[model samples]
Each structure stands twice: as C-alpha cells, then as structure tokens.
Target: MASDAPADSVPALPDPVSRARLVDAVRFDRDGLVACIAQQHDTGEVLMMAWMNRTALEETLATGRVTYWSRSRAALWRKGETSGQVQRLIDLRLDCDGDTLLALVDQTGVACHTGRRSCFYRAMRGDALVALTEPEADPAELYGR
Candidate 1:
C-alpha cells in the first residue's frame, strides 16, 4: 500500500548505525588510500605502517585481521598471509582528522618480511645509519623465497 503523504512531507528516517558508517568516516587520500600504522597490542611496539584502500580497511574491520593496500602489487595484501605472521586486530583507531589509522594487533611471529619483529630496525648513529636489532628469523625462512 502507498502512503497518503507525499515523499517530501514525510519526516526523515534516522540513519542506522552500522560498520559502514565507521568506514565512511575515514578520509582517503587522492589515491583512495590511508596510512595505517600497526602496533603491538600489549608491548606498545610499532610493527609497521602500510596503506589501506577502502576494501582493505573494510575487510580488516569485518574479519578482525590486519590488511593493507599494496601499492607495489596494486592489490589488497593480508598481513602474514604467506609468512604465518598474521596480525589479529585488537583495536582500530583513527587520527583526529580521520586521515590515518592505528591498528593495535596481536602479531604472531615476525612482523617484518625481513624476519624482524618490526620494520623499524634501523637507527641513525653519530655518523651513519645502523641496525638497532637483528633479524629474528631469516628472510628466506620467513617467506620461503
């Protein structure tokens, strides 16, 4: 049955709160991507930073796993998919402007493909860059490459 009132006369319905609303809140850059920093949930150690397109973000949120947009591969890359170092999302937060995201996760195994716990293993010494930490596992062993 059709309503007697015209469409314009009806009061506006409240938008249902949904996960899509959270995704919509993010402000993607020109390339439809945002920077997402992955951090260790309990240790407070930064694991890595990567880009996430809408699809990656949505999938991560829906699955409670960490995913990123691989600019190099031009595809959505699920962390630890091949290396057995998956990051299970504990929480996801956005910066004040909603331009960046922080993914706190429970990381299994090494987070870096280089077999390091983190990508940030380098530091600047007095005169040159240096490796602050050694790889926990061999790269070849981690990726089986």
Candidate 2:
C-alpha cells in the first residue's frame, strides 16, 4: 500500500518509464508478467484474459496492437495473426490495485479461439450453464496444427 502523502506528493504522468518506476507503479508477479483483461470498447464485452510480460506490454504500447505472452507456447503471440480477428487497442488502462490490466479494444471479427464473438459467451442460469453463440469459424481453420 502507498502512504497517504500530500495530495500532490507524486505527480502523475500520462505514461511512465524507468525500471524502478514501472516496478513501483505497476504490480506484476515475480515472473514479470501481469494478468490482462481484454474488453470490447464499444460493447463493453470481455473478449479475453491473457498474460503480458514487460516486453509484451511495451510492444503493445509501442505498436498500438495487443500482444500477449502465450503460456502454452512460451512465446509472444500477436492476437488474430491467423484468425484475422485482431484486437486493435483503443486504450490501455491499469486498475487502482495496479495488479491487473484493462485493455479497451476495437475488435474485428471473432475474438475467441472457439470462433465466438467474445471469449466469454457462456451464461449461468441458476444451476445450468449454457453457451450463447455458435462458432463463427472452425478453430482448426483459424489456427492450424
């Protein structure tokens, strides 16, 4: 927790840099990766949740595109590279806790690997959980083996 210093104790910058500053300003795990939540800017729909390391974060900000660290592949992946359903970052924001990221994006086509418009297309009604939409396209067609 930060100390309750004077209201203007620390000035705010539209953007931040420096290792120590980034460490103190943003919260990240020991692995240098932070949990990122992607949402549709216009619809307010949660598209996906993924991890972003410092490199990925910087790359996203620098390129105006969303890049994420692929946990399974152990590599950096540009979203929609194969599917053509790319997420164009409208804004990148941090929560008060600084532990999580909220990405406001303008998404094209489907945003889920399952070929859904959004990754979270399931609804919980009482004890029943139901899928909302059919797959827009086959996963294999978007991402090959």
In terms of TM-score, which candidate is strongest? 1
What is the C-alpha RMSD, rounded to one decimal, of candidate 1? 12.1
List clashing residue pairs in candidate 1.
Answer: none
lDDT tens digits, residues 4-109, model 1? 1122211221233455787889999999999999999899999899999999988777667677999999998988777778887777888999999998888888
lDDT of 1: 0.81
C-alpha local distance difference test of each model: 0.81, 0.75
Candidate 1 least-lDDT 10 residues = 1-10
Superposition TM-score, candidate 1 onto the true structure: 0.87
lDDT score, candidate 2, position 102: 92
The TM-score obtained by model 2 is: 0.78
Can you give the lDDT of residue 38 in candidate 1? Answer: 95
